[model samples]
Target: MPVPGGSGREFNYPDVGAGRDDVSPAGYRSLEMVRELGTGDQIFDAASRRLFGWQMHRAAGIRLARSTPPPAPGVDVRLEWGVGPIRASAWCRVVDVVDEPDRRGFAYGTLAGHPESGEETFLVERDTDARVTARITAFSRPARWYTRLAGPLGRLVQRRITQRYLDGIADDQW
Candidate 1:
């Protein structure tokens, strides 16, 4: 489906796949978070699955309102936040996918209606020592008034959610 208020062919932000790059665009907040999930290929495989299957977002306390299973380039997803009657929704389209022997991940750029204009990537990697890690990279700026108003609080929330993503993946229960 076409993103609302968006061309459906372009992202709301100019640096469309910047999250996968070493440097983020100017005038945007750049964030990079890394967490050691554990060791072994089992952890790496499970973490990758959760991230791509939308389970990581759910574990982060965000609702996956709509999304295509097993994210691929051009797939659109809608995520919702808030409690009870009050909710805020954000739209995003997958921009890239990485599926290599030692790494797995995907990057998505925000669409219209998203509170932030940018891209975010989630990745799981395994090193030769069998060490597994989860990483999140993003570059964004508030696109809506509320997000701008929230300021630092918005960044705090983002960090908390990112922590949840790592913690959830680390949990072997799933």
Candidate 2:
């Protein structure tokens, strides 16, 4: 299924549970690019940084899977760009699997992050026109060393990284 948001780029996931599935997060469909904030990651009244974010619009399907499916517990995930890459691997455990009448199928995962990701997935719904939609939530505790180094701009720095990621996605054709 082509995620419906941008251009309904076709995507397919096969034998997702045979092993670890290398599904693209962007393929979850209806991945609306919201917004990126912060001037310098300031957590106070004002931020020194400004970045992109989402306003609101119709959602749609996305292409997010490899050309071929692998076996179970054998997922290889990587996000590559100019910065380098964020490679994460995990044994996937499917959460909820459902195909609804609203023109959407939902599938969440228990093996999210690296060796230590929690639980997350897309409810996978569609709009009146059948555009996909879902939310992705991510949380991380402050690193003690990094937090101390931040002193003040810790949040701003974090926001910067996020901004970069969002920019990459928006600029990317995929």
Candidate 3:
């Protein structure tokens, strides 16, 4: 189904399980941070928990419009922006989750009716220095006519949001 005020087009998952390559073909944004999180497993566990708990999105000023009890691949989720009458919603699906020895994270793909078309990955990794890192990579293009018209403004907004997510990660207590 289309998002509340979206284009009403049926969303497609043509690139299911595409993972990081899904954003490789195009110019995308990536942000990373490294810090002390005790050990590799501890960092992975904390970051993964924070991700599935929706704290990252919340820190970026997005709230849960709708959610499932526990986050997992293929789960449907909705996020809301702004407050009061100036609110908007975006629908998405958890495309995949990662749990490797040196890396852990999840990716979510935007539905057809959402403002963007692409996937975003949230990853936590342990570097050779034994420091834990959190990374966010996104590849997207405007999905709506209005967003396309906004062009540069849309990109600027995305950058700001990316920064917000980074700040959220840094400020996150978990």
Scored by lDDT, model 1 comes in at 0.83
With candidate 1 superimposed using the best TM-score fit, by how many Å does residue 172's alpha carbon deviate from the native? 2.2
RMSD of each candidate? 2.7, 15.1, 4.4
User: Where does candidate 1 stray beyond 4 Å?
Assistant: 1-10, 65-67
Q: Write the per-residue lDDT of candidate 3 for residues 26-128, one digit (tens) a residue.
A: 3444333344445555556766677667777888999884435345676667778987889998888776887787877788778766887767777777877
Off by over 4 Å in 2: 1-88, 110-115, 127-132, 137-174
Per-residue lDDT over 1-174 for candidate 2, one digit per residue giving the tens place of the 0 to 100 score: 222222232112322331113233332312222332222212111110100111110011111234323211222222212323543223333333334443222233333232222222323234454343332333222324545565447545434544443343223212
Residue 35 displacement in candidate 1 (angstroms): 1.0
Better of 2 and 3 by lDDT: 3
Q: After superposition, how far is residue 9 of candidate 3 from its true place, in Å?
A: 8.4
**Selected candidate, larger TM-score, 1 vs 2:** 1
* Best by the lDDT measure: 1
Q: Give the backbone clash total of model 2.
A: 31
